[model samples]
Target: MTCFAERAPAVVACAMALLLTACGSDGPAVVEPPQETTCNGVATSVRMLAPFESVVLSGSSAACFALAGGDREYLVIPQLTGELLPYGGYGFRLGDPSPAVVARAADTTSASIPSLSAEQIFGDQVHSLDAQARLDALMRRREQREATGVHHGAEQPTLSVIGVPPEPDTMRTFSVLNTLGETPGYSPVTAKLRYAGARVLVYMDTLATSALSTSEISAMGAVYDASLVPAVMTAFGDGSDIDANGRVIFLLTPTVNALVTASACATSGFVRGFFYSHDLSSTAATSNRG
Candidate 1:
């Protein structure tokens, strides 16, 4: 990542100028603006001062903020409405019970098993144990198991842990290829759809198998809906763009893209943009314009 220290001077200057302009009057003493306004046509006002640009996200009534003065430019989407939709990455599912492995009783009549502690296994230096001491402790545990008729060479129980299954080899391969900057068997796909009356942006790694993995998407839906969606809706309700620059830029992530894919927005068409990068910072820093 590019260090902020390398870009601080320009950012500081732009921020200072923005702050000064926000203070209303140009004198050294800051003048306070009116607390309330009686503008009837539009209840809210969206302002874009120097060194900043406002943009309306395509197909949505959301406003995005972008810094215009610095070389390292990034877009900031305002808060979204409501809680984010739950996201589970390409991993095990929650609340699933682990498989239990049980051993057959060697002698059902003898129901007693010896209980051993750390002191018995490691002597007085349990806290300061060496590798040899650890090995000896493990050997003692093995002996206890052997005494209970649990043979070391016995075939263990085959247990399957209950959870989400592993991703397919195709998906795994695609993930690897994506990291290597190769678009082997899939092309980038994007779509725009309306969910609960709010516009949604969807980007997909459209593959041949049509199998989807949560690992390749973005998880910022709730934040975008809460912050950017309402603002866009308001601005568009009044028939205005959030930013005069016309387009809003968003740093896409795997989790966020996953949310769109899981939602009703994954249908063909409504394509807007291409897949850029999984790293948001790199995407933002390199995006010169929306």
Candidate 2:
């Protein structure tokens, strides 16, 4: 698909030296209302790096919006500290019940970290739809959009990206995945919004996002069970770059975006996957050229 025009970021972004970038806004437009920051009965916030063992998501600023109604909640993750680069889901804490644990975005300014996973936070089973197969179908739709000459289609939902440059070489990649998919237990396909910036990226999807590296999964599959990723997280929790192989991931979106699923390291080495999702955030507007 033809990539849209570039939008200039807010003029008031700060600087983040690491992860090769810094500061990006959560976009200025609010298409929805605001919601209270709570998962299950516990409160959730962007600042709390609780039970999460990997790099905590932080940044210059984050925006929060409310979901209409149902049995589910939604979050919009914008530019983060390179944490949103992967194609998976990651929260600040390990929710109970393991696979089906839950997550949500707290108030933009809240400070308490909530538990994660569908079972841990919501105490309900996450709809068990085979993530890989669904993604395959979605990818096929995107391919159709590319062929039928649809600049804006159901597959590539429009999204806005504003590049706030604090320096000459420094840059932050902004993304917004408006509508991903849904499951049986929760809501009906909410918009999985994401924004990856200097130090923060937040996403709200109803399932365990399956955009992860399959080759890596298969190779590491043999080792992933006893891999003890949390243990590694604990070791490098307090110190950045402390872990020699920090965490790496792949983006499996076949929609002609930026990077692809080739990032998996030999499908054998360490590629610390943090958060991942399928994105089609329809951001409209471009201030750079027009």
How many residue-pair clashes does candidate 2 contain? 41
Off by over 4 Å in 2: 1-131, 151-161, 165-200, 204-290
Tell how far residue 173 is off in model 2, in angstroms.
19
lDDT of 1 by residue, 58-109 (tens): 1112211112121222222211111121211111111101111110001111
Runs with alpha carbons beyond 4 Å of true place in candidate 1:
1-198, 207-218, 236-290
Q: Write the per-residue lDDT of candidate 2 for residues 77-180, one digit (tens) a residue.
A: 23212311233432332122111222322233222322233332222221121233233334445444545664543544323243331332232232322222
- Where is model 2 poorest over a 10-residue stretch in terms of lDDT? 1-10
Model 2 misses residue 49 by how many Å? 40
